[model samples]
Target chain A: MLDEQDKNVIRELQKGLPLVSRPFELIAGRLQMSETELIERVRSFERSGMIRRFGAAVRHHDLGYTANAMVVWDVPDGAVDEVGQSMAAFKEVTHCYQRPRHPGWPYNLFTVVHGRTRDECVQISEKISKKTNIANYRLLFSTAELKKSSMRYFE
Target chain B: MNLDDVDKKLLKLIQADLPLAPEPFREIAESLGIEEAEVIGRVFNMLEAGVIRRLGAIFDSRKIGYTGTLCALKVAVDRIDEVSAIVNSFPGVTHNYLREHTFNMWFTILAESKTKLDEILDTIRQSTGVEEIISLPAEKVFKIRVSFELD
Candidate 1:
């Protein structure tokens, strides 16, 4: 539902804000608007739930948290919500969601855990399993990150 | 680079919302009892060191009417590099990774509609000669927002 101006502002923002004392000042100037107007627009976007967050994208790998694993679990269809909520409550788990299960892939719940080592990640997953009481799971660790970038909504 | 106490504090501060004030960095400096110049300098250094991926607004993909799926492909080991290149060529493929599994390649592709997503996935399968791709689209999101606290 965003208009052209909103899209333009978002596109500019995805490129990243100017690292000046007043970042919005330059952004607003470029967008042909006042600083106050630009901030207001961003606030409205947040209010409308379009802008989920406006913050720093930290590089967890650089923060000494080297371990990362995507743990997928096969919870009963009826208990998916309960198990998913329980899994998401843990601090180590960052993203938890219920994804579709194909014929061969019975995993319905997926959670990403980060720690200092593989053992730490496994321990966290075990804790989640004990809490959720779902044992059918698998841990997939990324060997390489081929690409990681914000999806560009506009050219 | 090692992160000193100041850098850690700055990272935590900036990870939350940057104040909407005209002098937002100055506001952060005041909160941390540091000079505005020091905040700017540290942020610049962190960006160069890749500690901060970006400073921007994150939009809700679904709210924006874009659909996406997390796809796992059992690509031939020798063909992984080429298949990854083909997948990455599509603008919709935002994240492509090599994971430790029979389905070694995993990536998320987003498009304006379900049809477009299917078309792109089909093209990838044909080009890579991969028979099956386990496409796991998110049915329900229990949690997504997370911020790492650097202690």
Candidate 2:
């Protein structure tokens, strides 16, 4: 739970830190607080797990990572935890989750894999499959990115 | 933009976490054995080239009292544009993509509450007139870190 002041800090922080020597000082001035107070609040948020990460959001596509695939697997319900952890250990697997299975959608475990080429993505998926022994899976490659933006909470 | 060795090292460091201090970039520069101005210059170049989409805090949606879900919708080939436009109109929709599958359109949306999430989904369905929409909420998030090695 966040008070109004904390929310205000987050709203400004989300816009991004200024690329200056003393970015926090500039932000603190706008929020009507001291630089030390602003940094302390941000550190507290990170410690509390409210701020999951505080760093650069790199666009993988621009870094020559053009191949991206969402690999969905139908691991046995009893072995999902073990298999999901194994899948996540791969450096290529950026995101892994156990999503609810819908009607006609038997896949429960989802992993987003990225690579420099389509073949590289396939090879990584095969490696993951061999490691996890989850054969019932399909790869859904993204044809187009319609929208990709961070969530604006306070606005 | 071509990334030199220094740029690669800097990207990897900044991708993890910027130091929480009065002069955070200076700390990064000290560790990288470079001047603070050089570090700032590289970051600025990457931003200009669209390599770094943002440099800021990433909040945990659930921890922050928000609910989110991933949805996939099946649409006729000709109506893909119309259906996707309706789906992407909602501010809650953070990621919308056209994937290659029967359920061709996929997106992830976040809302303040479960009710609000469902209402947004319902409105998208009604507006698009697409009946085959499935929402797959995460039962367990095993991992969600996205870090790329530039080596």
Candidate 3:
């Protein structure tokens, strides 16, 4: 149960915090609240899991890890937790998930692998496959990123 | 263009959590034993270079009462651009990508409800006229709520 002020805070935060000596002061000033109150609210948000994380969203591609692939696996339902945990242990595997499987879509587990080259990405996936022993998988390399933006809940 | 040790250190620090304070950058600088201005300058440079997409709060859509699904479409290669634009037009579609697979176009849509999410997906399918579409909702998020370590 968030108040209007909290929503306002979230809306402003969704855009981004200012890069300044006192970002919360800037935001708190705009919201007409004390800096301590605003900071406490933000801390509460983090504790309540409203905010996943509060920091820089680094673009991995710009970090020189251009090679990226969404590797989807058809892991056995019984072994999904075990395999997912195994795959997620890799340093390059950033996002791992258990998505529902449709009729034509047999792949249920997905993990994002980032590397310097396509070969590197494939090699990472191969290593994960060998480690997890989940052979049925597809490396869906991104051909083009048409749109990539954070979800705007308040706006 | 490789990052110097300082830049690497700054990046590793910034990627996770910035101290919630009057001067978060200064706190980061203190940890690294660098000038606050230097920390700010490097972050700005990285942002300008597209290394840091944005410095902000990352929210959990589910916790915020948003329902979403990952959709894949086998669009024609020639119509990829057109279809992508149509998909991207929806504000709910946060991520749209052309992937190397039979289902070439993939995107994630988030809405306030399951009904709204389904409606958005239906609208995209109706407008795009792409019959072959697959919607994969998250059954279980085994490893979300985490960030990648830059070290």
Best by DockQ: 2
lDDT winner:
2
- Which parts of model 2 have CA positions greater than 4 angstroms off? none
Q: Give the clashing residue pairs of candidate 3, or none.
A: none
lDDT of 1 by residue, B1-151 (tens): 8999999998888887877678888999999999999998999899889998888788888887899999999988888888889999999889988899888889998998999899998999898889879899999999985478778
**Could you tell which candidate, 2 or 3, scores higher by lDDT?**
2
In order, what lDDT does every prediction score? 0.89, 0.93, 0.87
Candidate 1: where are CA atoms >4 Å away? none
Q: Classify candidate 3 by CAPRI docking class.
A: medium
Q: Against the true structure, whose TM-score is highest?
A: 2
Residue B44 displacement in candidate 3 (angstroms): 1.6
Give the per-residue lDDT digits (tens) of candidate 1, residues A60-105.
9899899899998999999998998988888888999999988878
lDDT of 3 by residue, A39-145 (tens): 99999999999888888888777667789899999999999999888887788888899998888889999998888999999999999999999899999999888
What count of clashes does model 1 give?
0
Q: Taking the true A–B contacts (Cα pairs closer than 8 Å), what share appears in each candidate? A: 0.87, 0.91, 0.86
What DockQ does each listed candidate score?
A: 0.82, 0.88, 0.75
Superposed on the true chain A, the predicted chain A of model 1 yields a TM-score of 0.97
Better of 1 and 3 by DockQ: 1
TM-scores for candidates 1 onward, in order: 0.97, 0.98, 0.95
Ranking by TM-score: 2, 1, 3
Candidate 3, residues B1-151, lDDT tens digits: the string is 4678898888888887889888999999999999999999999888888788889788888877888889999999899888888899989899988888888889999998999888888898899999999998888776763455555
